[model samples]
Target chain A: NAGVTQTPKFRILKIGQSMTLQCAQDMNHNYMYWYRQDPGMGLKLIYYSVGAGITDKGEVPNGYNVSRSTTEDFPLRLELAAPSQTSVYFCASSGPGSNQPQHFGDGTRLSIL
Target chain B: TQLLEQSPQFLSIQEGENLTVYCNSSSVFSSLQWYRQEPGEGPVLLVTVVTGGEVKKLKRLTFQFGDARKDSSLHITAAQPGDTGLYLCAGGPGYSTLTFGKGTMLLVSP
Candidate 1:
């Protein structure tokens, strides 16, 4: 069903480089989120959007930015990639209800050297 | 910060054995979800429990929500090798964000 799709499955960047991770969903959900998973640590929210043109910072928002230009797309931007930014990034989408289960994308493995 | 604590960070058992995973939190949540993730893949939702003291069964898997909605449990009966994966529990406060547990890595060897 291609619920949630994320581009750039893997990437490597030098310190101070920049890149954008793409995410798109076909579920027509109203909420989208960006999260990073580090070794042994649980997923941490980076940014989220309620709907198109509505975005907000999450728990760990530093070094990352997100934009929700449409209901189907929410992209995450890295301004100046650092070693700490190396982690697996995941994109998730949910329906209108706040308690609805979130559908996650496969994730993007990012490496900063 | 609201946190979900999962017990037994790792589990390895033979096939046909039963196992249980627990997720606990001090803060109450409106709903909780269990997800199973394989290597190199995102987590897939296994089940969601909302009401307190609610029990939902999916085939050989059982999900239970605590009476106070602050804890949950996932029990697998006669687990098979296919069930081996990383299990995560997330609590939702009826909003956009969810607090996730570190996860339980299960290995059911055949």
Candidate 2:
């Protein structure tokens, strides 16, 4: 069912470079989230969207931006990549219910040098 | 901000051994969820506990929620290598956002 699909599974970028981590869900969910996980650390929220055309900054939003132009796509953008931004990024989606369990994408391994 | 603290950041046990991991927080949550992640993958949902003092079992794994809804535990009766993963605990504050603990990395060796 391709619950959640993320593009660019792996990428390497030079300092000051920019890139977009693409995420799409076909479940017709209303909620989507972007998170990054450092080695040996828990997932940190970067941004979230409750529905199309709506977005909100999460706990860790520095150096990143997000847009929700459609119900199926929520992309995360790194304006100027830095080494500190190197981590595994995950995208998740959930139904309208606040208590609904989240479905996650495989992840995008990003490295900035 | 709500925070969750997990103990024994890392654990390694032999197969068939018994072990328990804990997730505690000072903030009350409407519900708590447990997820397990393998190398190179996102965390996968294991279970969710809502009612305080509730107990739920998933085969050999048992999950319990504290009476105050601020703590939870995961117990493995007979561990196996397949059970090895990074276990994360998240608390929901009756909203769409969730606060996640650092996580307990488990390695069940054969």
Candidate 3:
């Protein structure tokens, strides 16, 4: 169904390097989110966008930035990659509602060396 | 920030056996969601409970929301190898954001 799509399934970046994670959805959902998952830790929200041109920071937003220039795309940027930022990045989207179910992409496995 | 705690961080059981995992929180939530994640994939939503004291079943899986909206449980009847995965619970505070639990890793061996 191509519900949610993420590019660069795996990537390795050197310390101090920068990169951007791409995420797109075809469901036309209004809510989009970026999360990072560590080994035992659960998914921690980095940022979220309610709609195009509107975004907000989540619980853990340090060292990461997100932009929602279009309704179908939300990209996360890491200005300077750090080892602590190594994680599995997940992108999710949900319809317009207070508690709608989120559909997630496979994920982007990122590593900082 | 609200936190959800999932009990039995790891579980291993034989096929045909039953198991139950718990998700608890001290803060009340407007809704709760259950998701299952595999080895290399993102979580897939299983169910969402919005009302207090509500129960929902999906074939072999049963989900229950606490009367106070601060706790929930997932029971698997006769688990199979295919059911092995990480189970996670997330709490929604009537907004777009959600607080997630660490998760419970389940292994069902045949």
User: Fnat of each prediction?
Assistant: 0.69, 0.59, 0.70
Clashing pairs in 2: none
What is the C-alpha local distance difference test score of each model?
A: 0.94, 0.93, 0.95
User: What TM-score number comes out for model 2?
Assistant: 0.98
Q: Write the per-residue lDDT of candidate 2 for residues A1-113, one digit (tens) a residue.
A: 78999999999999999999999999999999999999777989999999999999999999999999999999999998999999999999987644678899999999999
Tens-place lDDT digits, model 2, residues B4-50: 99988999999999999999999998999999999988888999899
List model 3's recovered fraction of native interface contacts, to 2 decimals.
Answer: 0.70
Q: lDDT tens digits, residues A42-74, model 1?
A: 789999998999999889999998888899999
Docking level for model 1:
medium
Best-to-worst lDDT order: 3, 1, 2
| TM-score of each model, in listed order | 0.98, 0.98, 0.98
Q: What TM-score would chain B of candidate 1 score versus the native chain B? A: 0.98
- Which whole-number lDDT from 0 to 100 does residue A88 have in model 1? 99
Candidate 1 accuracy as lDDT: 0.94
- TM-score (C-alpha, index-matched) for candidate 3: 0.98
